[model samples]
Target: MSRDCTDYRDIFLNDRPMMDARAPIEFAHGAFPGVVNLPLMNDREREQVGTCYKQHGQQAAIALGERLVSAEVREQRIQGWVEFARAHPDGYLYCFRGGLRSQIVQQWIKEEGGIDYPRVGGGYKAMRTFLLETIDHAVAECDMVLLGGMTGTGKTELLVQLSNGLDLEGHANHRGSSFGKRATGQPTNIDFENRLAVDVLKKRVGGIQQFVLEDESRVVGSCALPLPLYRGMQVAPMVWLEDSLEQRVERILQDYVINLHAEFVAVHGEQGFALYAERLIASLNNIQRRLGGERHQRMFLQMEEALVEQARSGSVEQFRDWISVLLREYYDPMYAFQREKKGGRIEFAGERGAVLEYLRERVNQRV
Candidate 1:
């Protein structure tokens, strides 16, 4: 029987069972949800076949592959497929392009008097096409909202607390900061997009009328945000977090100090600690030497001293007040310009806890 099939769109959306016959690595990066991996060839063998194909052409590659696929090996693979098929009786199978790999497996099943194993029409490529097309359509239609703030205003924390919305940063396993690399390592761009797509699908299913996301640059580490999603975020409504410097610094230290210290040491070592201590001093020195050295240095020294005291005290209220003053004198003006440039459709400015609560209420009302 012909093994030609078209696509897995109906199967995936309708929850029809499916299995993948691609190698583990291919499936690892991205695969249709619920699709089981029943690879026809293992990693080393696949690589060897590819090398042969490149060096000696398709006929030679096929001959070498056939030699490699001993009867015993084929039986072992067929047995595994039989077990999987028995477990998922209605399951269909697919390979790279509804091609040889899938045909080999499907034919084996039929010969064994197993259940019919229809191949996905275009196989993995078709599924990928559907994912890309669906993602593009969703991006155009979805209402995206950006959650923007300075370094440590609990933007990510608040994103988690929000009852309604998607958490792109969390999905990426990143904090959306300069120091946001995951301890578990980052996902590939395709993996990241696949995760994002799954999140979007879940939100849509849950009746999410709009998405809330952080205002991020186009790239997050090695992963690039899709153009459509990025554009939606750019034009979407925004909520800027405004927190006092003392609060901001305290929050930053709390978020970063424990989780990031090892990474910082790896990157900057002992010198990093000294630099951390002297950053304000260095900035003050530069200002004093050029613009208004004396006054700037004095202010810097005071701020530096206050920071040290706050660190020593570990008092949340004290840190909050300190960050509040810093925001008024320092972070506010800088953020003002950025907000004006952003010109977001909506703006909610206040303390982190209060702002998040208000935003959550608003989102709930809308929903």
Candidate 2:
């Protein structure tokens, strides 16, 4: 075999494990799912090499890089590559452009470790381009639906139950609302886009000619939707989810207050509640201008008192007061306006089970 794989669709569809040979900063900015960064050069070393290349030429930079990663450092890096190669025999490795850096790694792995591990042809740049194209292609070719609902009508909950459902919020690691932030920070925009592209590609490859996505703003948290997909969503058919106000309140309580606090506790351990309280207060404060001073202060007081009560007595009952008010006064009206605007596109409107059944049937109709 040539051992230089360029089949981007198959690579992503199979969820192939990948070793990213880019610098740490490069990987941090964006990388595919199931990829592990095992950089041939750290950020400092890569910077030094880039400077040398610009000042002295390619030969001089190559000499400098060899000098920088000699002996002990070279052996250590090779050892990691060997371990990864042994573990994922079918996996591939790549640098930013499948050029000198990856070739060097491949050569070293063979010379030192007696393994002929394959490298991804054209590397990260090419794979990323393929994924971007995947999203655009799906936007052009596939039948898409947008699931919309008032706050806490369980749109996301119903979305996950379908084979063709595309959970945009899950991919963005955000809930797509003011209180949507999680304990951990979101991925970089590039990372989020890459993840979403891979998902669309894999689903399409699995024979899904249609996809059901949440009706989202152009931006989800800090991650912006691909322009093609966003534009498609603008004209796509919509399914409006509905629920009783009492049920919506309970769902919000579980997802935003109880579950979100537990998530913070899990991530931050001893300081979880403190950080969770700060996040909640900050989230509310973010909307202070819109909520107006009087309403904001009233809700803020309710939130603060609720937080205090929860801290002291583990009583979350008080949180319902603020959550219900915010839903009724803030979220409901805004979403009602959205529903009216999207009324022409609303193909079906129903409660959770009904909406889920309709979406499933829509997906089936496309088959």
By TM-score, the best candidate is 2
In the range 258-330, model 2's lDDT, one tens digit per residue, is: 9999999999999999999999999999999999999999999999999999999999999999999999999
Question: Per-prediction RMSD in angstroms?
Answer: 7.1, 1.1
Model 1: how far is 335 from its true place, Å? 5.3
lDDT of each: 0.69, 0.92
Candidate 2 regions with alpha-carbon error over 4 angstroms: none
Model 1, range 1-367, lDDT digits (tens) per residue?
A: 6445564454655566777899888887777656789898888888998899999998898788789989999888888887887777666888888777888788887787465667787788877776676668777776667888776777887887765556777767776654455444667677677667766665666677667788888987667888888877777878877776666777755654434444544657766544444543443354354335555555565656655764577333333443344445455666677778886465676777777787777666773
Query: How do all models score by TM-score?
Result: 0.69, 0.98
Lowest lDDT sum, 10 consecutive residues, model 2, at 358-367
